[model samples]
Target: MIKSLDIVSDLGEGFGSYQIADDDSLLQIVSSANIACGFHAGDPRTMASTVQKCIANNVAIGAHPSFPDRVGFGRRGMDLSALEVETDMLYQIGALNGFAQAFGTKLQHVTPHGKLGNYVVEDSKYANAVAEAIAKFDDSLIIVTLPGELAEAAKKKGLRIAYTIFADRAYNTDGSLVSRNQPGAVLHDIDLITSRVLRMVNEGKVTSITGQDITVKGSSLLLHGDTAGSVQMATKIRDSLIANGIIIKSLNATK
Candidate 1:
């Protein structure tokens, strides 16, 4: 039986006056806030404001770094060398850390965003670069990644880790997320999503797109804030998980 789970979502994904999701609502529901670090979607002002909100709500703050592609929202792939990836991660993490310090808090973890995040799961170069950067910056910071190469790299680098899983996205048979470009890759039905969350948390398993059962030993589950009806879905997931006797808490919560 699952005793607890940490629900996380991407926040601070806005620039100046343009906002992507209703962050205020999502922050109340999620235990962790993966704030954008100005590489993909946030500006300096946005980052500071978001950090303040996280502090206000007592939510754990995380740095969501990505390839420097604001126009593509960091969803597009880039051919960056290991050195480039390391520098990008360091720059973004440091920027957010500064804001966190100003707000009287500190970053609890680092989760790569979009394409950079996906590549870290399989590409050794990218995974090692990210792990090395985090280790060099602050070895105490948790490196959030899937249960694969990225996790291994972080372990080798002597960094703490938190395993992550997606609640609304379909996974391939190999435990990888289905491509967003594919049809039915992103789930919307509240009932379906809640059911999957229960299985993932309780049984430590999730059904893949090909109908294969895959092991998903995740301590944290991600609900994308940019998805339509995301806030409502997050609420439902949280309520149902609590009703089932699973404690909703942040991974960084005091043990």
Candidate 2:
């Protein structure tokens, strides 16, 4: 069972403008902020502001890089080559790092967002490409992926990996995320989610949608910062962990 999680708040493109929801969410919970960069979402202003906010809040800042499709909000998969992904990863991370530099800080990690990440998880070829991208950018920058797949790919390429498990979503036996279109994909029931998460932490496994036990090495548990009632869920998760004698800390510290 994994404990002492490094929780992240993914701020897709909701940074500068209409920041109320995000700002309020950040204030309550979140130890890390995965700020989007132009491709999937976010603009110059939003990126700058988001980095600043994370710095002010002492939250570890990261680049939430994604496919080049803002219209689809990076949820739609793109047919991009390895070179393209490599270049895009460099561009997004560099952009975020530049903005973080404005505040005399540096990005702590890189979490690939939405469709691109999904594609890589399903394709070993693409996973290799993604690993190449991260390795080129900075081998020290932790590659945040769905743990099993990309983590193995990144580790083989000599890059540090964070086994990122979603606190708001369910998993499948294949170790892929259950499609959002499915009935049990997203858990709105806080009690159910809490129980599931606690079970995973205390048991080192998540029962898949098909009832098979999937081995999970959860170094970081992600709480979707954009979901409705997300704040309440995060609060419950944090407090419940403490009450149960589980610690809330960084994955970096754990490793």
Candidate 3:
């Protein structure tokens, strides 16, 4: 039986005046926060403020890095050399580290954002580059990724892994996330999502888009703040998980 799980959400994903989620409300609900590091969707001000919130609330903070694409929201894949990917990871992680240090708190983990995140599962070069970069920068920084090349590369690099699943996203039969372009790729119904998460939490499995059962490990569950009713969904999910006997603990706190 699963004793504990981390409830994490993407925070600080806004740039300038454009905001995405209710960071304040979600901060109160989530155990860990994957904050954007200014590449995909956050600016310096946003990152600093988000880190402060995490520190004030005692929520674990993780750096969320992505390709240097702002228009596509880092959802568009970029063709870059392994060195470029590694350096980009280092840059983003370092940027977040500065604010964390100023706030007297260190980042607990690193998770790639958007397309950079999805490619890490199938692209070994990309996955290894990201893993190597994080390990080089700070081996203590946990890597939150699915059970695939990313996790494997991080393991080989002697970094801790926090396997996660998308509570609001669908999965493919091959254990990859269903593309956002696909129909039903993102779930919206609150009751449905809550029930699906409960099963994934307790059974360590989820039904894929092709109607196949795929094994999933959820040391952390990823919730999206950009989605409709996300705050409500997160609150309900956290409450439901506890009601079902699962403890909501950050990955940094769990063994």
Most TM-score-accurate candidate: 1
**Lowest lDDT 10-mer window, candidate 2?**
15-24
lDDT (tens digit, per residue) of candidate 1 on 1-255: 558888999999999999999999998999999999999999999999999999999899999999999999999999999999999999999999999998789889999999999999999999999999999999999988888889999888778899998999999988899989999899999999999999998888999998889988888899999899999999999999999999989987864
The order by descending lDDT is: 1, 3, 2
Q: Order of all candidates by TM-score, from best down to worst?
A: 1, 3, 2
TM-score of 1: 0.98
lDDT string for model 2 (139-230, tens) is: 88888888555767887888877778778888888778988778988878888778777877777888888889987777677888667788
The CA lDDT of each predicted structure is 0.93, 0.78, 0.92
lDDT of 3 by residue, 1-255 (tens): 658989999999998888989999999999999999988899999999999999888899999999999899899999999999999999999999999999899999999999999999889999999999998899988999988899999888788998888899999988888899999999999998999999998888899989999888868999999999999999999999999898898987845
TM-score of candidate 2 against the unseen true structure = 0.92
- Checking candidate 3 for backbone clashes, the offending pairs are none
Better of 1 and 3 by TM-score: 1
